[model samples]
Target: MINNTIVQELIHEIVKEEEGVPVVECLMEGSITDEEIAEKTHLKLNTVRKILYKLYDAGIASYKRSKDPETQWYTYTWKFESEKIEEIIKKRNQEIIENLREMLAFEENNMFFACKNGHYRYTFDEAAENNFRCPECQEELEYMDNSEIIQQLKRELSLYENNGSEIAFNFKSYS
Candidate 1:
């Protein structure tokens, strides 16, 4: 499932806001040069190289450097780590689940206070320390019912726990 949405989203996160999906799709065609990928994806060569480097840093892409005997110039042939993608996804999902659990626990254990504009949130101790006033707007802080937030976190945690182990692999090619 290299081209699937989950994989694409992961790549997007690694590469930031740039559109890395098309570049990833091109890499799934087997080992290829960055220039070839740029041409195939209609992306700027520099942008393609940047994405390749970022993916490499993230352990999702790798490259082999070759020296041309005639020109003595180096060329990089890049390959996507198709096998590692699923593992990366599982690890990241687990981290997210753990963070969600912590947040849920914090919400369950403490009361929250917020400003009228929702610009700030503080735990009971923090609110008390500040005399129940917003630091930014100087408005009186009011008790914020966080049951909805707690429920949302629980639902998200449940989804991740249920689906974290069943990531399917259907990559087109591996190198």
Candidate 2:
């Protein structure tokens, strides 16, 4: 039933696959002790604890601490917050969409010039201030056509807007 790829990738983001995925899987089973997680995942106790703490810090995992009365040692029981995980992903996607919108607006508003040597890019004001020459390479700056870039941003923005947060992530490491 753990079919959420976003949760999987979020865990992969919290720590390396060697540690993160297994720890997250164990936590998803229900509240579990670090020792139990290590035993189930076949990872070192310390490694499991580390991954758990990282997930905790990321707001997708939480732990309950209790004192073992006879042993006088603290025990921690950890659980994965599936709801919080989805919230984090949606917030991240919204941030990405906002950034893309800002980029599209800037692209639509600006006239850009770039050096032939590809050393610099400047807006109209900067290019005019420098006499349309590359300050770094002393090459004449040429008008840069950004139509393709604008089109690409538009396409990407449209995808996010239409699909909401359920679109596939381009997380190269996880995917």
Best by lDDT: 1
Tens-digit lDDT string for candidate 2 (1-175): 1345666676787776557877777787889999999899888888888888888898888999999999999999999886676567778778888999999999999999999998978999999999999999889999999999999999999977865634434232332
Encode model 1's per-residue lDDT on 1-175: one tens digit a residue: 5447788788989998465888888888889999999899888899999999999998989999999999999999999888788878888889999999999999999999999987899999999999999999989999999999999999999998887755642333322
Give the lDDT of residue 55 in candidate 2.
85
Best by TM-score: 2
Worst 10 contiguous positions by lDDT, candidate 2: 166-175
TM-score of 2: 0.90
Residue 49: error of model 2 in Å?
Answer: 0.6
lDDT of each: 0.87, 0.81
